[model samples]
Target: MSTAPLLSVDWTDHVTGRRGHLVVDRLVRGVASGGLRMREGCTAEEVAGLARGMTMKEALHYDPRNRYVPLGGAKGGIDCDPRSAEAYGVLVRYLRAMRPFVERFWTTGEDLGLTQDLVDRAAAEAGLVSSIQAVYPLLDDEEEARRRLADAFAVEVDGIGLDELVGGCGVAEAALTALDRAGVPYAGTRVSVQGLGTMGGATARFLDRAGLRVVAVADVKGSIVNPDGLDVEALLAARDAHGTVDRSVLRPGDREEGPDAWLSADAEVLVPAAVSYAIDTEAQERIRARWIVEAANMPVLAEAEERLTARGVVVLPDVVVNSGTNAWWWWTLFGDVEAEADQAFAQVRGAMRALVGRILDRSEAAGVTPRAAAHALVEERLPEIAERYGWY
Candidate 1:
């Protein structure tokens, strides 16, 4: 609650010769949950910051309306390139070493540069079970592999892949809620997405399906823009296994020269679903979107967010927009998964829309940003929770 992590652990993978950090911000009801990220230059401070955000996210999500599932916040990060051959070995050793902490204190899933398959494989090799899997026996490694294969083939595998569906679905729900609150129609609304990874790609696909024009999408390689709207399905089909859409598949007019082109594309909504600090000062200056639905954690920097707020851009914080995945996780862990994945997705979407609408309404009433309003809401409840647990 004080922004200082309750616990921090530095780990080294002796096998692959990599190092990482794990930070737990708080423990509510003796439980914490978050993702493990492996990026090129991840840092301990970054993991701590993400852990703080996760704490705030869990606080914001489990209000009185929902039967409080007391989950705390934690995050893990490794400063290694997951694309390297040594990556798998590094993960196996890391998980094996951290098995005790993971099983007892913090549970982690996939984040940037991490896939469910990797988590499953690492957990399996480490002889550890995820906290969620411990509670719900259905979420085993074989089932996870089946779900991954189903995702690859675009097949429905008995709702085993609901967790993946919720992230993008939640982003689209946030975007739609923002547009509706602003009195904008979805049919002709233009959207520009930065980062064509899992979250961004899902956001683009869902928004395009919802009748919004996806004008531009960018990845690490470069950007492509078509003012009329790009074919989301075609782009998905043409994308490489690494989630990069080849520029060669694009027409001459569709290609954008730089990676940051999506920042300046003509659109009403901009969804930054990539890495953190995407909307820096320079990006803030070039942004043309009136609304930003953050699909990634802390994609916009503090100064850039302030600038966007001053420019009257309605920036939806990631705490609200991206919390759907957490909601889905809770639902799957507690709710009956015998139901269809679409049904679960619809439930999560409705909850997200309601939460977003409430946050926006409160922000408007208080004449503050949604981020501020949501944080205030969480802060108001933290004292009672901490007092009950003696967290101070």
Candidate 2:
């Protein structure tokens, strides 16, 4: 459990003095998979931890009957705000510097501050064939796999791309599974979410449709709280490319509060789908929700989770919750599922529910938190995967 990875590279952009890092946690079949993120405070240690989480995410989905064997974990991050004017140039330069790795081992897409289109654009600018082309060598039919994934990405549901919805679909399913186990009916269950971007927005939509009341949602502007659920679709439609909602779309009854107010909302479930370490010890004190579903990576700090656990609040780990996006890509490309949305959704739901159940079961049996239970599950799988493919 040392945070050591197989390889780590740090790059400094010449033009703006910005830094970037990539960490390959482990390798399976000569490749690793994760995503690239751009944010101002990114660092090598953060990327390394994320890479380790990717390893866990990949290992958790392993199955002998499935064609999509998980690859090694890896991640890339750049220190620049995505909204900054020079962000694109920094991204291209970082990709250019890491081109060798992208063409060989690390297959990445969007994460946190970056989008798929932006990553694809930057990858192309860096002279790479594709952001994921490094894994094409492992495919049965490379061309067919490429076309299928492209088609899958092209398919959109209710104006949002299919790729954006799967992760949220998985997150919502995890929450529902937790609620079901506790015998809590979804009809009156209230939920609050932080972030209105791809993961959070999609989660709100699905949870609302699943009979949960989405009472509050926080974006960069502020938290929009309405006692009776806000209009999920309208807010989603009103968001800019950066996932910030236009203030003009707010309803007369919606109360706008500070960014962190969502933490204290009167809801059974709270989702931190935006930034890492958002719920520190101070913020954790404000959360009254019975369940904190992590749709974002490392949103709950260790100390805060310890305090929350003592208070009997369940903190679902991101490795299992937000893993649907990564699993979907491999499932589609590996031909286990087609590019269609319905089949993709069914697969994600089945996989997430099973994983959540197992984690919670293990939590009770082992007398550990759900995050610890998930870590134990990954620990169980890593060896099996290693035995089959040998360590990199």
Candidate 3:
């Protein structure tokens, strides 16, 4: 339980003068798993925090019976807006500079401000075999595993890739599991989602399909809200690469408000599915929702989570709530599940539901937050994993 990361590196892009950081929090069987993200103002501290969260996320899903034993945690971040003309070059150079780690130690994929396809392209342009090449050595059948993961990535549901939907699927299921445990009805429940991109859009869609109303969804531009329910599908379809919804997609009854207005929407559930550290202590006060499910990593600050817990608002930690996407990648790559959509969805839902149930039960039993319960679960499981595999 040391707080120190196993390794940390900072790189300066010579062309754009932007900086990128990498932090490997831990390693299992000689490799660590995480994602690379690009955004304005991304820092080493933020990347370190995300790497630690990846550790917890991996440990939370540890199962001895499964073929996919959780790998260790790592993360990479670049301080540049992904929309900038030079961002792609920055990403390629960053990958090139980190090729040694990518080859031997760290397995990564797309995160905030990037997509898997983009990462693959950049990695290829950087003269790399694959973004996740480091994990190939552990696979039982490397060729089959690579093919399976590629097929899984090619699978799409409702116009969104399965990889993009799994995390949100897990988030929606986590929310539903919490409601079921609390004896709350899903029907007519209102959900306000922040971000209409991959996570938020998929989460809203799943919740809507499950009979909940997504009353409002905010993008980078502004909030599009309709008390009755905004059309989640339409908005999702209209979103740009950055998750911003096009204003022309607004319906007759939808009202546009400031970007931060989703915080004030009257809803039972609020999903922060966008950037890290989005909701601060002061911002948490504006939220009227009973539950804040973090579909994005580190969306709720620690102090804000403490205050929200004091106010009886349950904040589902990112470590548990947003882990399905990562888990699905390994599940496919490690042969626990096939490349098929139904199999992947079934595996993700079953695992995420069970994990969330455990977290909530431990929360009530120990009189602690779900995040605390999740951390405790990780603490218990990591030792077990290390006992079997030895910490690398």
Candidate 4:
């Protein structure tokens, strides 16, 4: 699709009795509605770009009869960290302030440091009901898999258990898809997952249950690697309230307490699920995994993605890996828990497998990286969708 202006968007900060202008860019409205993004350094241009990306992402994963369809994407930005109560409150207020606009076309979800509780708080303060609640599964349970997505415009969550479950399930499905495309057997495959928050931890558990050996997993504090595979169930059982695994409870192994330790683990598959740009130039050189799947958005920088691709490392794009959050919004909003889980797991796995296989095949044919091919595919689809809607 053409990278053209879609919708005009602007951000104004009126917290200190004076308005502070941030970003004003295009908001591309597709078939229905779009996602809302919250970030620290979000520019009007960047957020617009993300909005456009959402347009393409939704078009690629189209669902009819929903206003908050993937086809239409909306986003928001707050210059605050989602981890702090004060910052979170401020963001929620900002979101409430933006409700006039949010009510018009966008469905808000958490992204990048935003939490479900924060999203709910913001919606409540604004007297705005979550679109998730008006829909299916969440309309029934609204607690588990159909919870709020906080950061990254429907990517992060405050306390949405269902959202996390679905997101992780999507990543795992994408990983399995890439593995199948590469003719790599995932059963008994040694896997290492870095970053054990909602996305990382959930993906780790899902993959482990799928019969893959979860050899190593890490979080903010530290990393634990066992070549013989760590029992994810046991680790999850011991996880603390903050999602940190009490290292003292696990059987000791060749453990390390550094950010880079996760890269050195002996594994066939490596999933970087922690943070953005986690894999750098130096870390890329030392990576031992034959396949790398990014469960985290932009976990590998553009440069690192290039190097890994050059070395024949198959990296599945986040566009494919972490789509569960988006899918959950619809499922939770429109269906039951059992139906939502079944559809989410099936969708991510099936789509990942298909998308990876197609991208890899095209990459081989065109002598480009899988990442490049994935980008090309999305780019191709976006413009077509836009044109179909008479946007261009």
Evaluated with lDDT, which candidate comes out highest? 2
Kindly provide the TM-score of model 4 when superposed on the true structure, using C-alpha atoms: 0.79
Q: Relative to the true structure, how large is the alpha-carbon lDDT of every model?
A: 0.79, 0.94, 0.92, 0.63
Q: Is candidate 1 or candidate 4 better by TM-score?
A: 1
Error of 4 at 251 (Å): 1.9
Measured against the true structure, the TM-scores of the candidates, in listed sequence, are: 0.90, 0.99, 0.99, 0.79
Q: lDDT score, residue 49, model 4?
A: 49
lDDT of 2 by residue, 143-189 (tens): 89999999999999888899999999999999999999999999989
Which sections of candidate 4 miss by over 4 Å?
2-52, 63-69, 131-160, 240-242, 331-340
Error of 4 at 363 (Å): 2.4
Q: Return the lDDT, model 2, position 285.
A: 93
Query: CA lDDT of 33 in candidate 1?
Result: 79
Number of clashing pairs per prediction, in order: 0, 0, 0, 39
Candidate 1 residue pairs in clash (backbone atoms < 3 Å) = none
Candidate 3 per-residue lDDT, tens place, 169-230, comes to 99999999889988999998999999877788889999999999999898888888899998
Q: Candidate 1 on 277-302: residue-level lDDT in tens? A: 88988779999899999999989999
Off by over 4 Å in 1: 15-17, 63-68, 131-161, 251-253, 336-339, 384-392
Q: Write the per-residue lDDT of candidate 4 for residues 45-157, one digit (tens) a residue.
A: 54554555455456556544433334355445555544444664566567667665555555556665555665777788767766333233213344533443332134333
Candidate 1 C-alpha error for residue 233, in Å: 1.0
